[model samples]
Target chain A: MCRAISLSPNSVLYAIGSRSFEKASRFMLENGFSPETKVYESYEEVLDDPYVDAVYVPLPTTLHVRWAVLAAGKRKHVLLEKPAALNLSELDTILEVCESNGVQFMDATMWMHHPRTAEMRALLSDGQRFGQLKAIHSCFTYKADDDFLCNNIRVKPDLDGLGALGDIGWYCIQAILWAADYDLPQTVTSWHEPELNQAGVILSCGSSLYWKDGRIATFYCSFLTNLTMDLSVLGTKGNLHIHDFAVPFRENVASYYSASQFRVPIMSEHSVANDRPQEALMVGEFASLVVEIEGNGSKPEKKWPEISRKTQKVLDAVRASIEKGFQAVQIVS
Target chain B: MCRAISLSPNSVLYAIGSRSFEKASRFMLENGFSPETKVYESYEEVLDDPYVDAVYVPLPTTLHVRWAVLAAGKRKHVLLEKPAALNLSELDTILEVCESNGVQFMDATMWMHHPRTAEMRALLSDGQRFGQLKAIHSCFTYKADDDFLCNNIRVKPDLDGLGALGDIGWYCIQAILWAADYDLPQTVTSWHEPELNQAGVILSCGSSLYWKDGRIATFYCSFLTNLTMDLSVLGTKGNLHIHDFAVPFRENVASYYSASQFRVPIMSEHSVANDRPQEALMVGEFASLVVEIEGNGSKPEKKWPEISRKTQKVLDAVRASIEKGFQAVQIVS
Candidate 1:
């Protein structure tokens, strides 16, 4: 993430902070941070820096609200990594602070800013090409090694407590929401037999969502399977497919497949090349938003934060459905 | 189907039958069947022919039992089209008579005969490449024109009574079962909001299945969407993807994609060339099984019958789930 920010033309990896200055220093040195980059022993020190216009919070999901709120309070633009927070309530808290303080807030979902994503969006919104969305299936899974499963922050109940559902599942849910043009689902239902660790953190799970208009989406996220990322969006007239969705196989050129009303359906692969990595683009996008607010005295962009909140709400509903023994949980919004 | 049977070197298109002699004659002429091929005014006439070793029943769901039973009673090998019967009871009656008569029974699920399917099965069974089966998603959907939606046999309550769930959904359910090596799921649950016509026949729907081992599968079938047929099988160690699972894009060569453990996950597309179309291969396989029974005095192959039964069972379960308002219906076998 630090490297991603540094790669952005308008962004800089200005500071490193951790409870341990040595660990932060090691991270800075190992990641080839500039020698002039500031190192702070406490997160408070980074937020206190007068020259720091923004702070990127890459803390575990459990700490998102605290750190993001602090950054917002300090008048720092907030770029928070996903899953944005443990739940919607926490995310709302962070967003509220950002709103009150006039700080731009965007979660770090790199794929959202990829050039390939824009190409996919273009095809999906074209009625003649894609028509009305019917169903979507998004999956993101990775085999987590024994060491990581046993000791990773993701599996720890106190850290990224949502585990695979929050870590990778967020991407899947986000993809579904993104494909649906951010329309909130009317109902959410989790699949039975969600794999959970001893601490009750989800390791793997799946859920389905339904819209009032009869459109539906299903997603699966797992830390117990071989690395696979797929986003398939089917519409009345066409289809959109992305295999390497969460992360592109080739960073520079991302490829997607689409077909429109073929007498014999045949998907044609379309590739979009980016001048910089997707993460860099995400950083650049976020940085530009922060620039607009800080330099032009513009209000913060609500789009990114609104997207984050919806993703968080859907995630919470999925968790609720899982907890309620896979019952259908109605989404009020 | 006549063309497929004629293409197989060992299987000749022996007979055509319809209620109308003119219709049967038209079919025989259109397909360029051997001039000596018999055209019967009724299905029973074709079944009663002493030289006809096998009969392919392409009748609608309501008529399957009567015609299949007649063929089996006449000691003709029964090659039944998919959604073999209205439900398990009907299929069981057909199977029982075939068993009693010592005649071969097989469903006309053409993809099962594709060489590419065998390659996919090999990879899925390989513990090193694919590991234990985890999740599957099979979707087969096609847009129905105005005329078809209003007048097609598939949409009629008394014809293809199962509607989309029986027509195209049959292929999706069969694909899931075939990928799972015919292990029946313990529970089946339909997604809410299945689209239905005025006759209460499903036009579009989806269902999810669960095994006791925590493996899961979901499938979507529709007549209200663009043409899309996909079978995605995800295992612990690898993934198998087939875009055109129900029908191959090319008749001579079929393509599929698979990937094993990769730190950087990547899918490699593979094409398997076939001497004939999958339908021809299916007919050839069924014919060979019949020949073994008739010539070698061997018992009918139990594999194909069992596969067809299981597919029908799952399809029935999905209907029950949908009828019961998307409740999870437990499978006895």
Candidate 2:
């Protein structure tokens, strides 16, 4: 992520921070950080730096509310890694603090900023080409080795808590919501018998989201299967399929398939090239928002935070459904 | 179908039948059936012809039991069109009579006979390549125009009582079972709020199938969306995805994508060519079975009826779930 920020023309790798000074300095040296960059022994010191315009929090999910709230309270723009918080309540607290401080906030879901995403969005929104969205299926899975299953932060209850759903499923949920133009689903129901580790941390799970308008989406995420990332959206008039939506197979160009009405349907492959990686584009977009807020005296962009909040809300509903024996949990938001 | 049989060296188009003699004659002429083909005014007449060793029944769901039973009673091998029957009981009757009469029976799920399907099955069966099956998601949908939605036999409740669940979902369910090596799921639960026509026939619906071993499959079928036939199976070590599982986009060759263990997963595109369409291969296979029963006096192939029965059993459970307000239905079989 720091590398991505450095690659963005609109952003600078201004500072580095870790709990230990040695770790921070090592990260800087190994990652080729500029020698002139400030290094902080603690996150608070980085937040306290007045020269720093924005802070990106890549901390564990359990610490998101604490550090993000602190960063926002310090009036720094916040870009936090996802599973934004342990739940929506924590996310709400972070968002509230950011709003009170008039600081821009966004989650680090890089694919949302991909140029191909914008192209997909346009195609989905076009009535003649895509028509009304009917159903979506997204899957993100990667086989976790014994080492990862035993020690990864994602499988630790205190660090990520939500496990596979929070780590990779968040991207699937976000993709579904994005395809639906950020419309919140009416109900969410978890699939039966989600695979969980000995600690009761989820290793694999799936859920279905239903809207009143009859638009439905299903997603599955796992740490127990081969690496697979796919998103398929079916509409009344057309269909869209991406083999790798969480991350592109190649950094330079990403491809998806699209097909319209036909008795014998034939899909046309569409690929979009990127001068910079999607993460860099995400950083550039965030930096641009900060530039508008800090340099031009404009209000922070509400769209980014709003999207993040919606994603978190649905995440909470999915968790609730899983907790309630896979019953349908209504999304009040 | 006549053309398919004509293309196969081992099969012959011996007869055509419909309620009206003119309609049967016209169909034979339109399909380029050999002039030696017998045109019968009624199905019973064709079934009564001792020279005909087998009969393909393409009647609607409502007529399946009566005609199929009569065809088997006449000691003719029966190749039935899909939605084998309205429910399991009706299918059981047909299967029992076929067994009693010592005649082979097969459902015309043409894709199952495709060479590509065998290739996919081979990959799925390989423990090293595909590992144990974990999950599957299948979708088969096609936009039915206003005229067809109002007038097509598929939308008529009495003619095809199961509607989309029977017409398209039959293929999805079969694909899921095939991927799982024909293992019957223990429970099936329909998705909520399936779209229904005025006659209460389902226009669109989805369901989830759960097995005792924690393997699960979800499928969606509709007559209300753009054409999409996708079957995605994820296993512990590898994944298989076919966008056109129900029918190939082209008549000659079909393709699917596969990937196995990798940190940065890369998919290999596989295409299998066919000298004839899948339907022809299906007819050829069925005819070979019939020839064995007659020419070689071999006992009927048990695999075909066993697979069809299992597919129908699950189809019945899905319909039961829908009928019981989306509750999970247990499969006794």
Candidate 3:
């Protein structure tokens, strides 16, 4: 995030915070923060800084609710890390505070801000090219080394209870919703037998989402498989596929495959090159929204929060489905 | 099948039987069958021909039981098109006849004989590279034009009652079984709201397969979506994915993506080029097995029938689950 802010012209690495002052100073030095950057001994100190316009919270999932809610209440635009909270209700609390404070709220899903995403979205929305979405499948997985699997905060129930779903599956869910134009599914059914750690935190899992109109989406996320990031969206007349939906293999160029009609023995491959990485672009986007609200007298961008809420709602439903023996869990929201 | 036979050194286009001798002769001519190829007006006459070693039944699903059983009873090896039968009982009857007559029974799933499949199988079996199989997802779909949806035998209930599940889902179920090393799942649960035509034939459907050991597989097949064929198999340490799994984009060269361990962001893409199309290779393999039984005094190969039976059983279970309102259907076999 600090790197993104450094690369983003619209944003600044204004402050660093840690429980220990020494750690904050070390992080600042390692990340090449400017000498004028403020150093805080604690998160509260960062939030208390009157000059701070927005705060990026990269704390553990367990800390998201408290920190995000406090940051929003402090009238700072909140750039929150993903697996925004343990559940939807917690995220709702943070969102409510942001709304009341007129503060912009956006999850740190960098891929959303990539230029290639807009190009793909254009194809999906084109009736002649993509048509109506029928099915989608997204998967994000990485082989976690023994040490990471055994000792990482992700595997700790108290830290990131959702594990792979929260870490990587969040992106998959977001991609599905994005492809579906944010239409919420009626039910979420987790695939049976999610691998769980001793602490009952999921190490790997998958789920199928069903809409009332029979449109469907399925996703798999794991901490046990080789690195794979795939999103395949099938439409009535076309299809789109990307192998690297989360993080691009290369810094400057990203590619996705698309096919329309039946004239394909080979899909048309599209390569998108960007001047800056997606994270930096994400930082720029969030900062732009902040500027609109803070300087241009514009209303805070509701699109970001709405998208995040829908993703969280589905995530909560998936967790419910897992808890209910992989049965279909209705998404009331 | 005719093209395959022509390409295979061990096989011959000995004869073609149709209700109309003129139609049979026309088909033979169109497919480049030699002038000496025998044309029989009746299927029984072709079966009666002493020179014919095996029969490839590309008849409708409803005709499979009678034709395949008759071919097996005649001591001619049976190469049956899938869905092997409308249900398992019909298939079991045909299998019983084949076993009694000592005839080889292999479903005409051409991709199974592709050299690329064997290469993928080797990777999946390598413990150090792939590890334990965890999940599999396969989908086969093609947009059936209005004429096809209305006039095609595949949409006719009496001819192919299983509909999309039988025609395309057959390939998907087969791929899942192949990935799982033919281990039948304990239960099959059809996804809710499967799209059905006015005649009560499945237009599109999906299902999840679960095993006692927590292995999971999901597949979707449709006659409603644009052309798409995907098979993603996830293992503990590695993963394999093929976009054109059912039919290669190119007849000679096919590619699949694989990654093992942490060296990803770039999956190793492997391409296998075949001297003949997969169908020809399938015919070659089947004919070799037939030759072993007839010429070498060897027993008819049991492996082919076993794999076919497993695939049909799963298809039946999926149909049963759909019949029972998307409830879980146990696989007694």
Candidate 4:
């Protein structure tokens, strides 16, 4: 939904191959896109479309690598949603293909693009305001609907990846990583509610990330919960809080305090909606990237592998913690 | 301090043999109690006093059993603050002494007397409001003050009693046990932060309790944190939330909701001070108990060992979990 709407004005929408071409055509038409948009009945048809300069692969978790590789084979830039792939190996494969094909590939993590989040990161990182970052805490949770149990991609581990952690925890993992300037943690210990479908699939999860400088990050994610998105960072001098990151009009406020004193009115950032922006501002950024790719051969932005690998490492540690019932799991990197 | 303030109206202060007599006298005078108020510095001096019919033992955690037994042997009713003792055997000793001497002993858990908490318990247990409770989640954390750390009795394994779980976590444990109608959990699993010191005892602690009927209770306690007290319970029909049990006035609201639909407000029994009146209410309850003991024989309203033993068992399991690091420890009823 986001991809079809985010393309440049002159960009062509090359519909991807799915189980039903007519349904895909109707989807495009309903969303006000031209019905004449090239509709591919198979994966090869979409890849072979010469007019298609970029592909937005919102496929199942397991299919992420396969589709990204196929898109890269056709030299098409790609935007993949969270949990880039099932594991680091698949992520590595996607990265290798995209890099070798000279195509721009980026994970659609819109959380970092949110203006409120940017403001928070700035306050926490600025040594004058918060000093050295000490700890990061986050919680992202929401109850799933009825169909979520039976046919949802999230429940199907092979498709949606890991349960709660992979789906929502990736945001928390990214939050900590981004706050610490992508500094990977050395150790991770986690605990998960055992009633989850499998040992690895958690209903509610908690983890602690230990960094080299004695800094730590703790996070909680749950599928069976009321909707909540909260991020808090404590530093030597002060602290920063971002209330809600996922929603546009949600109450997003960042506050910094020193020596137990409120310093100023909490800075407020209002999210700008480009059009049908449901998930993240990343859609707008991805749209800009498409223009950049069309104008120049490459983007000056950071490469995909650098950030994707860091996220993959956190996800891997989180998985190991869940499997080990939250014993300290070493981050190989 | 609580005992002296509670007995202020009686114009009599009983100081058991533990601290210096001059020190007790100075403490009483500093607190605005009359210096002439009877201060028997020794345990025998206080017990032999015809005016001293009750005792409040704020001794070390391990000495609770010994002092309570001695007070009971002297036919003095007792109000002993938590952890009850180091173990169940000590509690048994106190119980036998009280029974033989015909003196009453009650663990001083003031949370039970908080009017709002009483209302919360009734609403949840009403069956029609919350149905059969399935789960309870609680957390209590606070950054330790300098004085608390300098005179850190809680750090001493035998003196301060149990770490976070025994001191602050005991409140959460009691809340769960009371909510579950004293039905002990069949299995318990726990995790504790590795570091413990005088300045910061336990960084973070979590315990999971599993009952025979599938009811689960989970709680977290930390001394190295900003103050937070929150509790939530989920049942078959609806859910209940007690924002802050210890200090009810600090945004404490209890309500039951089903499927996003608001039910009737779980009526909170409003005491004179519904806000942060826990301290005063605790003093009043103890004073009333003192009056009951003086008016009648030593026996008051409830026995101590029954509740103390159950709490100790839970604390023991939490300690085992801390030692085992994520291993489930079964509670032997």
Q: Against the unseen true structure, what C-alpha lDDT does each candidate score?
A: 0.92, 0.91, 0.91, 0.66
TM-score of chain A of each: 0.99, 0.98, 0.98, 0.87
Clashing pairs in 1: none
TM-scores of the models, in the given order? Answer: 0.99, 0.99, 0.98, 0.77
- Predicted candidate 2 versus true structure: per-residue lDDT over B89-114, tens digit per residue: 99999999999999999999999999
- Candidates by DockQ, descending order: 1, 2, 3, 4
For model 2, residues A1-333, the per-residue Cα lDDT tens digits are 988988999999898888899988888889888899999988988988999999999888999999999999999999999989898889999999999999999999999999999999999998998888999999999889999999999999999889999999999999999999999999998888789999999999888899987788999999988888999999999999998998999998999999997423789999999999999999999999999988898888999888988999988888888899989889886
Docking class for model 2 is high
Q: Which pairs, if any, clash in model 3?
A: none
Better of 2 and 3 by TM-score: 2
Residues A170-225 of candidate 3: C-alpha lDDT, one tens digit per residue: 99999999999998999998887788988999988889999988899999998987
* Per-residue C-alpha lDDT of model 3 across residues B6-30, encoded as one tens digit per residue: 8999999888999998898888878
Report the C-alpha lDDT of model 1 over A1-333, residue by residue, as the tens digit.
887888899988888889998998898889888999999999999999989999888899888989999999999999999999999988999999999999999999999999889889999999999989999999999888999999999999999999999999999999999999999999999998899999999999999999977899999999988888999999999998888999999989999988779545788889899999999999999999888988898899999999999999999999999999999999977
What's the TM-score, to 2 decimals, of chain B in model 2? 0.98
lDDT of 4 at B330: 88
TM-score leaderboard ranking: 1, 2, 3, 4
In terms of lDDT, the poorest run of 10 residues in model 4 chain A is A253-262
lDDT (0-100) at residue B150 of candidate 1?
Answer: 95
